[model samples]
Target: MIEKRAAQRHRVFKGGTITFENGGIACIVRNVSEGGAAIDLDAPVTLPQSFTLAIARDNLVRNCRPVWRSDRRVGLAFVQ
Candidate 1:
């Protein structure tokens, strides 16, 4: 199979926050790459098309847009 991702993702286990207007949720970052990251949510919940993802331990924050989702996992594409 062909890999369509722009960058290779590395496995990760880090805490992250999915933040948007007056709201936020705790998430576990499962994988990361230059292009984007995959996060594990506590449960399935609606999220805005665009939001901020903060990884406190790394002191990194970036805007993200959802690319795909599962019951508890969300794939995000970093936006400039």
Candidate 2:
């Protein structure tokens, strides 16, 4: 695959929350960087076009849009 990220991501194993206006789901943060992150769900899920990713352990929350998705993982890009 061609590298397209503005910053490089590093491997991680943190817990995360994918939250929308109505609800949320638990996820595993597989990798992360300043610009974005890759999170794995228990299974493939249909999420909103935009949502917030909350990593309580890191005391971080970012608004993001899905850049790509696979069977269980989603690639996210941070939004303002």
Candidate 3:
């Protein structure tokens, strides 16, 4: 297998949420790095181009964009 990630990700199992102006959805942080993260949603849901990912315990609120997605998981890139 080829490693294509720009940065190494750390495994995590923290609960989080994706928030938009309209609403939010529950998700789990599967892995994370400085550049991006992999999240698993409770169910398949359409996400906007940009949104905020909040992990309360970690005190993290990052602006992010979806880079890739499958059934119930999404890969996100941190955006300014």
C-alpha displacement of 5 in model 1, angstroms?
Answer: 1.2
TM-scores of all predicted structures: 0.95, 0.93, 0.95
Query: Any idea what lDDT model 2 has?
Result: 0.95
Error of 1 at 26 (Å): 0.4
Off by over 4 Å in 3: none
lDDT of 3 by residue, 2-78 (tens): 98898999999999999998999989999999999999998889899999999998999999999999899999999
- Model 2 per-residue lDDT tens digits across residues 12-77: 999999999989999999999999999999988899999999999999999999999998999999
Candidate 2 TM-score, true structure as reference: 0.93
Clash-forming residue pairs, model 1: none
Tens digits of lDDT, candidate 1, 1-80: 99988899999999999899989999999999998999999999999999999999999999999999998999999999
Q: How many clashing residue pairs appear in each of the predictions shown? A: 0, 0, 0
Give Cα-based local distance difference scores for all models: 0.96, 0.95, 0.95
With a 3 Å backbone cut-off (N, CA, C), the pairs that clash in candidate 3 are none
Quantify how close model 1 is to the true structure by its C-alpha RMSD in Å: 0.8
Decreasing TM-score order of the candidates: 3, 1, 2
